[model samples]
Target: MLKRIILILLVFSSSMAFSQNGENTWNTLSKVEIEKRFDETLNFEVDYPTFSEEVKKLNGKTIELKGWMIPLEELQGETYFVLSSLPFANCFFCGGAGPETVAEVFSKGKYRFTEKRITVRGKLEINAEDPMKLMYILHDAEIVD
Candidate 1:
């Protein structure tokens, strides 16, 4: 029937549209690729890659993220680290992952860097600019039991 065909077409088009709206796009942004073109100026000027509105909307809200803990500092007792969707071997720094897949974590105490994926809850901050930091930040984050 024409009605059945039209319904199928509608569903197909909607799913196709969703595919291009930055879900896959965000997953493809590697740190190396983004770091090459993005900048954060002393005067607060910033230039970032194309970002999803969904990600920007999450800024400043309480969120629970599940990822692997990666050490970014050489200090013996550094609490600040990166939480990535992948393990250290496949993280952004290792050139096997993308930028959006990682977030800077600020924990009150030293967190043992783990090879296993873990979940942490905190305030999600989207840092489009800020050369001193990663693109995503989770403030006051804690490991979720």
Candidate 2:
């Protein structure tokens, strides 16, 4: 019937729309490729990232990512920390993983350190200019279930 065909088309269209919006994932963020370039100001070579079109599109957009928390300071009431795609022993700082595997997270709420993987939502910023910071920065982040 005509009504059945129309309903099927409507459902298909809605599912297509949902699929297009579901691209915010860690794999999409890992599309960035970096090359070491000499910085005249710092007088040293630093890794500079070249973000792919997919990763570039995520800049300034609120995205959700799941990662293990890397506490910078003490275990209690930490407002800022690093989130790594890998666990503690295999993280960027300790293991051989690249900078793309980590993100600097800045949150207003204090969080207790946990070894478990945590999901966070925030606006992602790609830091190409600041050598002192990580290549990926998450601003106004909050831990989510």
Candidate 3:
């Protein structure tokens, strides 16, 4: 019983560290511009949204992103997670939002979740390949307020 109680307290504290009110928010969608490329020979081509010149310049630079924390797994101490524009039930993964609504977050350390919105600061890395990863990736991320 003691172990369970301790674990519960730790969970609550961790969640508080991550949760935030709706005071500060970052807009990532406008940073990129979507373009369509047509290749008649191939059935599919690169039609995904492309990052604008300004956004591309931000690559490998430290930046702060605001979004709701989405746990990749039920286990705690997850180093990598997802940040969504909406809540879990209405996030991009749930088909209620667009592709630009979610980003794969790779923090400097582990991150836990609360229902409140949160902000993260890290080095941004954009990937055009590797479907296993999200196009917008934040590396070396840390929670800020």
Q: Rate the local accuracy (lDDT) of all candidates.
A: 0.62, 0.79, 0.66
- Mind giving the per-residue lDDT tens digits that candidate 1 earns over 27-82? 32232224355233555534354556666666687666666677555732466778
User: Which portions of model 1 show Cα errors greater than 4 Å?
Assistant: 1-47, 72-77
Q: Could you tell me the lDDT of residue 104 within candidate 3?
A: 77
Q: How far off is model 3, as Cα RMSD?
A: 10.2
Native-referenced Cα lDDT, model 3: 0.66
Give per-candidate clash totals: 0, 0, 1
lDDT of 1 at 70: 75
lDDT of 1 at 131: 63
- RMSD to the true structure for each prediction, in A, is 9.8, 9.3, 10.2
lDDT of each residue in 13-72, candidate 3, tens digit only = 443222133322234344666555655556555446677776677678777666677755
For this target, which candidate reaches the highest lDDT against the unseen true structure? 2
- Whose TM-score is greatest here? 2
